[model samples]
Target: MSNLATKKLSGLLLKQLGPHHLSSTSAFHTSISNATAENSKPMITGLFRTFILELRNHSTLSSDELMKPVQTSSHSAQGKSEDQKDQKAISSYWGIAPKKLTKEDGSAWRWNCFMPWDCYKADISIDVKKHHKPSNFMDKFAYWTVQTLKYPTYLFFQRRHVSHVLLLETVAAVPGMVGGMLLHCKSLRRFEHSGGWIKALLEEAENERMHLLTFIEVARPKLYERALIFAVQGMFFNAYFLTYIASPKLAHRIVGYLEEEAVNGYTEFLKDLENGTIENIPAPAIAIDYWCLSPDSTLRDVVTVVRADEAHHRDLNHYASDIQCQGLELKEAPAPLGYH
Candidate 1:
């Protein structure tokens, strides 16, 4: 064929094939080159070179048209791009779209910190006064450690219940995350099931985080308090991580004692609310939804449920420590899933 005729043919072929077949054309060119190289046939090699020259010329001329389809695809992707832009500081190409959620009443679920299925009514009937007396050296050591931490915190926050509980929840959420993570690694290393303890501990962590979120709606922490939390969380997370690695028994025991202190703290908060020392304001909307409380529930009711939650946590940690004291791995016992 003449040079002009060959160029025309390649252009026509590209037009007929459309943009999607451009990659196939490149593949065909590659295969032809490989075949020509192997066969060392002069006629075939000449034809292949001519074809490559025509394709290159045609590609330059039709570049705009080829890019049209790509532009159309990019336009289609604009919606996803816009969605990602709307999300602050979170850009991902993983296509992990968020699901729209609604409450039973058909209202849009507002909280991303938790989902509807995570919400549950507190077992207010759980014995808040239940105390695990430290019988052994380990138990006593844990109790005193918590006590040593507790008195200083009480003196610092004084009767400022909101600030006190805010800090409490910050520290409270740590052990579960550390325990869950260590257990997860252990499960992977040992190539055995975690007896649901990983999920249980993670559940506790998320629950405690929800508590912090709920309280945040009620009271914005002071700058100093926020600084305190920053310092405390950094110190506590590393400390607890090391402690859990060294001795899970002692770690769990300490958490149990800490929960006991939390229960006491919230109890004191309730008493203040009851005596009108602190106003019994309407419960934060997050708290009401999280605890599945009545629409008209008050701060008093929120504190009641939160205290009950602490009690359950206290029991769970004490139970964990007790199991360890019996000289068995946590995996030996079935985890109390959804204990709170």
Candidate 2:
């Protein structure tokens, strides 16, 4: 074919495929079909053979060059470098990259909700039966307040242990959060430290939330029960916030009594489990991990650890109230971090 004729044919083919498809190998076939419709059979045959030769020449280099492994390795390395750059960019954009964690057995950590450092063996030896006797008017009022709240809850749930504890945990989780948030703001406003009280209270809140998560695995709540939680949590959070603002002593005292009630309730739960009134099922995985229980641990073990935790919370809150009652700021005494 003449050089001018070849250039004309190439232009026609490029125009048929459009600029986007010009570089695509598949476009050649479509171009050939279009050309056949426009030209005589003899001219079309010649153009097809010319295009095939051009494609073959462009597709391959010298035999020695095609056999080289270095090219393949270099291309793969370049691709890997680009992928690493993309990953780094994404990580930088987010400003947080998850750390890879392992268990003591060197197995991959399975939970994103909590880290291994958060796991601990519950101090089951803690005295669960310990009670704070109401020594004054405020103490008496706090005790009666908890008692008043406790009875109606008992009447409502009766022996529904899972549902009862689930609701209990939801309420239990709130006070710490409210106390922590208030203390955090107070510390910031005063330009003073919280004597670690903020961290301690937040930790307590997290621990109580973990209890809720553990129970949820055992028994999902019904719609009505969840609705009740919504109403109760909203009321309790606001009421406790105001109480904490008015008097941290009375607020802590109320939480101390509430913890005492929680311990008592768990004791009852254990009794039922022991007597076969409630099935002593294997512990939920979340409970086992959180409490650092044995793989074969049962629900009885879970309740036992939870009861111990309540006992510790009771002591800590009562101690806080005691410090405040003596006209000392909570910051004067170091918080019992990791009390449980």
Candidate 3:
């Protein structure tokens, strides 16, 4: 990391967290001063470990890189100063300082820090037909279980991808939350650390919740659909909770397949939008703000970003399953923190 980028990241840490949370002395902290026997806080660590690396890794970027300069009005000299003030306010809201590094292209310089990977695009159009099929009987069982529960939505909702996403997200968010909670309890009971898996799983749950929120604004589901969400969430929550307790590996594998199906569904949604089967309406404000989409972004753009997010989730859950296959716990490996 460059000296300027390091400084910017350190500043970001100072603003969002107390010194007891993350000291400015190092790129990462192993522990904090707020630790207590009754409520020992877990160490802050994860895939964010690579956040402050050299510029060779261009795919992942910091929050600073997402920032664009506010265009100054050409009518008056005061316009430039006004833009600067407004920029400061925006920066403040994000817990960023006023001192910013700008690139020649008029965008903020990419800093070495942890930020959401919303900008990462995946090659979703790849031919995954072979990969989609089961390789064995056990794989077949998992595949069939997912497909059985999944295909019925098409008959019920038709091409209502927006509402489908809302329902899917509600169920998808459950596993992470359940996993995190169980890990938290396990850590407390065994007096063993989770190696950051707790936080990582919790973050995944929160991310899925945000996806549901964004879709709710876009779809505005009917009352029956809303009722279905409640029924699905309640049943899926308990089912996933037990599944995780019985075999975390199988649970993760299930989610991995679920996310793969989600990616496929979103791709179909994108195709329908492009084919004029679905209206390319303006993106919901929440989606625009959360994904940092352009002002003129439409539903297609939102789906693209959401699909990217689902792809990342699919990778993560499959990786978790792989760890279990190796007779290791998720705590044995680092979890991708801001993986879209």
Candidate 4:
């Protein structure tokens, strides 16, 4: 018989309705509209002015262990401090690189990429200027990935299965999300942006690794289902990211939206940890959080730092909009989830 554990994840996802998410999204839409309103570019300096005050209450209170994040790093070379080393572990989960933009209203006319590469797949080592050169392997890889991951969000939405199914689903899904994030991180690397994003993704990747490992460690270890999830996530994200490189606008916004959502989920997870209401880490509800939010609780500081990366996503969205808006007039209406 199908246990309640499988259905449990679905129910938990439906329960969150908080102001941080609503306001942040709303603010995003409003800012986008303001930028393009009147065919005018507003000075972007003050856009993030109230960032700390605005989101402070929304942030989860930190634990004594996770207070610094520096104390959380794994062993590394160059003798970097723990925080710096820890920063190197979670690369893809941070959403610190370029983002994907989607219409909150669920409009299909989404922004694809900011720089417009077309994912032609030439030599992967080529500079951004040569991205359009089109290699057969890259194009083929992107296509396969999209086809495989066609149902990520949908599959994630499904409820009622088994404990092994849940573990398999989560293990499979996390890596795809991690890889998608890595592609974005690499985008920043290509653009010569700061190493901060790279560092963040590394940490996130580590987090994904932990979750995957944890699922594997479970008594059942549903290897077959887990494999399916991995393949789907891997394929979908690679293709999605290739498209993102090609268009780089709304695609990035989608990324930003997802990351922000992840942050919200992680922050909530920490809150649960604080309350005795969330007793065991392996509780079915907690497992859902593991699958959907972040899987890295080994270092509580990871939640704060990873969430900070989500906060920084707003800046990237603003930057991408500015870059992509070459004389295009932005309408003054807000879109769903804060797209204008």
Candidate 5:
């Protein structure tokens, strides 16, 4: 990856993290209220200052803070921050499932899943329609994962009003995940069937609905009063993800791809449920200047849910394909790729 790409990925990973390790703030009304309540500058002004490249409608964070120095395994094992100490109990309030045994430390869903996530190489990087007769399903599965993470970095950053292109993509994509599922169902009958993969998909879809509400609820004022930019970018992402279903081979890959995502989502949900209530992380110093809520909530929770649902969708797709691909063994094109 280029330096910029590397930095963005780092920021994405770090956005959900805390000031230290165990810790990670609030809605716009809360910030404005706080700002009005105290004309005196915050004690930790630097904490609120923009870090890396600022997106429109928001202040930027420091590159160092944004990138968070990709940690070495040893560093991760030893370096625990002061904030991490306070976060242990607070994390439990979020209700994330499978809380750690320590019981007194922070409980982040991603934190708990770090090891397993590292091991889970959800690679979906193959050209399905063009490769094999009935095409070995394995290649399509791997491709789905890869296609999911790849990004058009520049388009992601392009400016439009207050949002950088990427944030808009996120805002739009959450609703898209649910819509795509509804449209992809085999028969209207399948939608009514509430069992196995269908049941899981519904749960995931509900979560996605919740996620969109959460994003808007957390950041309502700006979106309601100011221009909506990130929301648009999200639409771009939404459309891109949906395009995959057009190709059966590609759809097959996505079905598996989504399953892995669903697994990650549920895994995080388990972490969150165990923890209790997850307090919103503070917006970057820069973002607070304009936007109120942090993007991490939308990014982590929504995407995780979509991924988890996708995981189930993959299963349904596979089952559906079992019969479709029986006789006509056609080579398939690759699946549409992009990170949720």
Candidate 6:
């Protein structure tokens, strides 16, 4: 008895499953105007639907539930409300929203480098060429550190600015990673967040390392200079670690001054390139790839981007110092995670 009834129902379904039957649904509509008209029409015809349901073998489910699969494509716009409810449930089941953007709204990732690309390209506006007098003991110490490093660079690597940059970047990359690591440990120990400082500092470290990598391709430093880089990096890393542990504010101020000097150095380098004192050769392939530069990028273009990055770093360090000066922690304010 059950087999006979199942065969009858199967034959009925087959009869209704023709191409013409599909035409009765809206999915294969050929014209936009007709599709729109079909979409606007009401789906429910109570009398007709009831009459069709009475012919079915089992009438346990409603008409809407029975037709759900076929209507899915046509009802996409209408399904948004249903999706919202499901999305809310899913978001609660997970910790965060699935579709949330990782970075700020405007910025996105660069393809080759996998670094954040600033959509609103901010220009370097700070006049780093101007010198500031030391106001307090901390300021004086910061000033002294920057001045102490300047003369050796000038006397030893004269006209070898690319090599100078390679050295600077090697040292510059250390502070951010150290700071980020320390902050990460502190946060974990205290069960507190560092706002966004850990990510921001790590990103800065990565950016500075990229600068080092780019310049290495262009500069090709001698054996002695590479040895000098090793010496300077080892000494500086230990000194900075201790200094940061003693007073983070003073350490940040020192970095700010260091970045200011970097900006000045790059400015002079740019001037030489412009005045034909130094040849503006094609940019390093790594620089072109990392910065998303044009195929015809030059040394000047690479310098321009590096200068802008230094200016941004200068501003960030100064801001961190200011936050510390006010007797507030860096966690009190949000860090600019994707400023680069």
Best by lDDT: 2
User: CA shift at 271, candidate 4, in angstroms?
Assistant: 3.4
Off by over 4 Å in 5: 1-138, 141-207, 218-246, 265-311, 327-340
Tens digits of per-residue lDDT, candidate 5, 73-151, equal 8777666664576565545555875644321124332323122222222232322222222356655554644355433
Clashing pairs in 1: none
Candidate 2's C-alpha runs over 4 A off are 1-92
lDDT of 4 by residue, 1-340 (tens): 1234323432342244333333434553365344533333231333343344344534664333223234333444344664575674446664665444333344332322111221111121212111111134533443344345334633653431233233333532343344336545665667643224333433444444434443343335356755666675676567555655565444444444444444445456556546644443443322223323333443233334334544444334433333444543122212122111
Q: How accurate locally, in lDDT, is each candidate?
A: 0.86, 0.86, 0.71, 0.39, 0.38, 0.75
- lDDT-based ranking: 2, 1, 6, 3, 4, 5
Each candidate's root-mean-square deviation in Å?
7.8, 10.0, 21.9, 32.3, 28.5, 14.1
TM-score of each: 0.77, 0.75, 0.62, 0.31, 0.28, 0.64
TM-score of 5: 0.28
Q: Candidate 2, which ten residues in sequence have the lowest lDDT sum?
A: 19-28
Better of 4 and 5 by lDDT: 4
- Cα displacement (Å) at residue 70, model 4: 57
List candidate 6 stretches off by more than 4 Å: 1-133
Candidate 1 lDDT, 1-340, residue by residue in tens: 4445544554575576566445434544454334433344543555456556656757665655543433476786996799777885644588666788999999999988788998999999999988999999998999999899888888999999999989999999999999999999999998999999999999899889888988888899999999999999999999999999999999999999999999999999999999999999999999999999999999999999989988999999999999999999899999999999
The number of residue pairs in model 2 that clash at the backbone is 0
How are the candidates ranked when ordered by TM-score, highest leading? 1, 2, 6, 3, 4, 5
lDDT of 6 at 149: 83
Q: What shift in Å separates residue 331 of candidate 5 from its native position after superposition?
A: 22
lDDT of 2 by residue, 85-179 (tens): 87753365557877779888887888878999999998989888899999899999999999999998999999998999999999999999999
Give the number of the best model, judged by TM-score.
1
The candidate 1 region of ten consecutive residues with least summed lDDT is 31-40
Q: How does model 3 fare in lDDT?
A: 0.71
